[model samples]
Target chain A: MVKLNEHDGSIISVQDVNFYYGASKALTDINMSFKKNQVTALIGPSGCGKSTLLRLLNRMNDLIDGTRVEGRVYFEGKNIYDPHVDPVDIRRKIGMVFQKPNPFPKSIFNNIIYGPTLSGAGSRSDLSALVEKSLKQSVLWDEVKDILNQSAMRLSGGQQQRLCIARALAMNPDILLMDEPTSALDPISTAKIEELIDELKKDYTIIIVTHNMQQAARVSDETGFFYLGKLIEYNQTAKIFTKPDLKQTEDYITGRFG
Target chain B: MEGTRHTSSQYEMELQDIKDNLIYLGVLTEKAIASAMDALLQRDTNQARKVIAADSEIDRLDMELEERCIRVLALRQPAAKDLRFITTAIKVNGHLERIGDMAVNIAEKAIILNAEPQLKPYIDLPRMAEIVRNMIRESLDSFVNEDLETAEKVALEEDEVDKLNEQIFRELLTFMLEDTRTITRATIIMQISKNLERVADHAKGVADMVIYLVTGKSVRHQY
Candidate 1:
């Protein structure tokens, strides 16, 4: 229910939201807000519904069977949960990157241009320009510029992950939802992704779900600590990690309990 | 659950090691201050020598703790609370080391005062050392438990030590003015008191760092 100003469009807002899996509730009375040009990290232990919460933002949860969501999700001041809202259109504006690097079987150029083409962006030159812009935004343009025609699957796991990020950027989404995007990456790759996230925050609103507390502390402006399907604490990332007001948050961050 | 619990246990063990070493340094300095005071009060040269000998261990542990803090900073790249902890560890290590040196200063003054007959009973100097020791212990506990309020309280107590330092200097001045024979002993005791005052100042510095570590606000210049 928290609201930010609309200077840069306020990005996404969740109000009194609830989710259920058949007869069991997965999220309860959740209310949160994310602003444009900032990174908000969702942190909690496994099975804490942090990933579920991320999916709910972009309506990716709609594909899951027996999953029921209630309440409103607003993006750009429009209610995304309205009956007439198209999930495809909503997803086009809000892109997502998964945990594992799942690059397509096509070339690196094709991987970057695939989403824009599917969305019917423009002609070949337009797609090429968009591809270059996206890759450059993700800081991967120079490394793979010579091999644009090569298969993306041949790239290393870290490179593929950055390629996936570039693919998400092609659509020029207003918000990006990343679910443990660097969990499978090595330390060097993790550092690169973290740096990319930092740079991206100046242009796009980012919501990241990370189990690594250090990553949350490093890359996030705000952090929400979720526990047992509830948002236990939400505050500035520095406060959450240094001196959390809640004992549960303190215990979790200090490694006293999880 | 087992894996998570194991990781937490290891983290706790590392934290406990830091806590124990800090307390060990605290106790050693506290004892050195007490014995240094005793040497000045009762003209006990042997106790002053013991205080001097004990300072070497305090110096050794200060280096060890500082190196550990640097290693943690390089290896863990800790953030937030952990980052504050390592940073505070470095500052507190310096404070404790300075406190040890002040104790050595007191012991040197005590040796000189003991050789001369005696200063007059030495009341305020012992009182200053006692307060400094408590400040040392409380500051370390504040850091070990991350208690911001306790750290703030210790910071406030520094004022009393400062006042006592002034009072001791005034009282010794009167004695030096009254008798020429009392001048040498009174001056030496005044130096011992001044060293105790500096130890209290260093202990307050540790307390200030603890407050910063807990609240992430610098209170170095503030009262």
Candidate 2:
């Protein structure tokens, strides 16, 4: 219920939000605000509503049957849950990367240009430039540049994840949501994805749901510890790991309990 | 509670082992200081030689304990309170080693003073050595228990040792001025007092690290 400092306009705000599936509630009253150009990490055990919360940010939860959401979610100073607002338009400003690297069964060039083409970006020259720019931004251009016309499924798992990121970037969204984006990759690929996230935070507001506490500590500016669908603590990453004010947070970060 | 309990119980056992070794070192240093003072006051050359010979074990243990601390820091990568404990152990281990060296200095001075006739009864010097010994013991205890209040109390007692040093310096100055014959013995007694003062200063340094370990704030120069 605490109002954070009104600095450079908050990119996303969740005010007293709660989500439910039929008669069962998945998230308690959750109040959080993420600043522009900053990365926030959500950490908790399995079934802790971290992914559900990320989906709520972009209204992806609306696709689930019997799901009900309460309270306001403000993006760019406008309430996204307003009755007049279209869910499709809300999705265009916020893009998502899932836990698995799910590239479509199409050419690599087609995958990166899919979103922009669907959004009605004009001209063949503009589309090609957008594809190149998105691929470069995701750090996948060099490896896939020569094989632009090859099937995306033919690329490696790590390359496919980066291609998924490029696809998201082609939409030209201001915010990015990654739900355990590197959980399936090897250590080297995880490192690459981590490096990409670090670089992407400079130009895009990022919210990541990660189970790895060390990753959260290394990459996030702010961290939220969730338990039983409720946020137990939220603070700076250094404070959360070293000298947290709440005992629950200290116990969790020190590996006391899940 | 489960995970912290596991790590802390392990830390507690290791800390206890370190405390036993440190206390063993403290007792050896205390005996050395006492015997060195006895040789000075009673003119016993045999006791002075024993004090000089006993310093080898203290030096050996100092190396052993320091090696253990380095190994733990490299292996465990301890954080927060555990990090503070390991760092304070290193500082305190150094302090105790220096105290052992100071005792050897006193023993060497006692041997020279024993060769000459007694100038005066060693009243304030033995008292200062006793205070220094107690400070070393209490500082180690403060570190073992993470007791901030006891650490602060030990820090405050440093002024008493400083005052005793000044008192010994003035008394020796008067003795040296009164007669040329008493100059050598008086200067040696002044050196012994200075060594004891340094021991107290090292003890205070250990206490300061304990305060930092418990509160996560440096109190080295704040008095």
Candidate 3:
């Protein structure tokens, strides 16, 4: 077992981790660390376990049947997979945003406040404050401040995605895990979200899994390249984009092969 | 390796086109340098004028290559070594184009020197020009082959050109001191030697970019 330490700037550390979906393995012997207040991007071809690794961070895979995670994932020096630890508590500290904008059928106000409301977090005024602060953090406050009562489904895809981000931010997570957050977004919206990500990194540790190489290059401080269930290379985003240490990483990023 | 074909054949072709055009540009600049030096040694004003006229094509290709690199950046959004290659291509393109300008500068000075009586026998100047020409060739060859050894060879030749340039200047200085009439023609020859040295420096610049493209490290001012 690797000794886990939290003083090293890393907020989460994965050591000797292997994951399986029933009998088939999905990730193998993965080891890496995510630093505080920095955006780390996980990039690889589709089904290369990049997204699977992102999901493993907060134990989101526990919701899937017949899936097992071996080894330890330390979050702030605590093993999240320990039976004594609560997965719900781990999740609240590490929020997530999905690929598509899956806002609820409720009003936009409800969508932002829903997570806190279910947790009985605070009073009505506190919930309203949380809604405003989360929306502002996601950079969607001005767009939807007047339309709080409108159904979230009525918002555009990009707005809905930002609203989902706001929904996650409402939980006040220390780390935000995004699995291809802007894959479905248009260029303009994507740029806005990317700008928001740059802004949000000052306050939150972000781990993003993206298939868009340029987006990974643009938004990430550190980038990890995964191939066939193994980490091929991990380095500064500039180094990874300009001159990766591994030929397989270079080949994939250059669009030579998947 | 760069030899692997891109999944998008069109993108692969676009990158290949830049390489081809650079090689073509390299050939033109090499010819201009050789011709300019030939004109100087043979005292042929007409050949010098032809070298001057040939620079417009090099300038045109420089603009064309820059636009293509920008297009690839905006469209294909290349990454890793391809990104390095394209960005390096932009820089190497500038160096090659400037090499062309240096050749034209030499040719312009050659025309002036050809009008007057012959200066001292052109021994060191021709040798310097030959080495500079080879520097440009080897630098471009390193870029095309991604060969570090060839790029290092070009860097080593830069010092050789510098030594020859100094040798020519010191020898010419004695002539100007002994007889002031030789000052105008000797100074023009000195300018031609300086231009050749500058061309060698530009070739070294191309070699530096090739090193960056191959190894992802900048060796510009380090040595």
The candidate that wins on DockQ is 3
Runs with alpha carbons beyond 4 Å of true place in candidate 1: A1-9, B1-7, B71-90, B117-121, B137-153, B174-187, B208-220
Residue-level error in angstroms, candidate 2, position A109? 2.4
Give candidate 3 regions above 4 Å deviation: A1-4
Across A1-258, the per-residue lDDT of candidate 1 in tens digits comes to 323335334678888888998998888888888877899999998978899999999899999999999988888677888999999998988999999999999999999988888777888898889989999999899999999999999998888999999999898888899999999999999999999999998888899999898999899999999998899999999888777888678667866563
Looking at chain B only, the TM-scores across the models are 0.90, 0.89, 0.97
Task: For model 1, report DockQ.
Answer: 0.39
Candidate with top TM-score is 3
The CAPRI class of candidate 2 is: acceptable
Residue by residue across B1-223, what tens digits does model 3's lDDT show? 3667899989999999998998899999999999989998998999999999999999999999999999999998888888888989999999999999998998899888888888778888888988998899899889888999999889889999999999999999999999999999989888988999999999999999999998989999866
Candidates 1 and 3, the one with greater DockQ: 3
Which fraction of the native contacts appears in each prediction?
Answer: 0.32, 0.14, 0.95
Lowest lDDT block of 10, candidate 2 chain A: A1-10
- Give residue B60's lDDT in candidate 3 (0 to 100): 97
What 10-residue stretch in candidate 1 chain B is worst by lDDT? B1-10
lDDT of 2 by residue, B1-223 (tens): 1125533466556655666776677667666667776776677878878877888888898898888777766765554455566777778778877887887888788888877778888799878877887888788778767788889988878999999999999998999898988988888888889998998888899899888877767899887
TM-score of each: 0.89, 0.83, 0.96
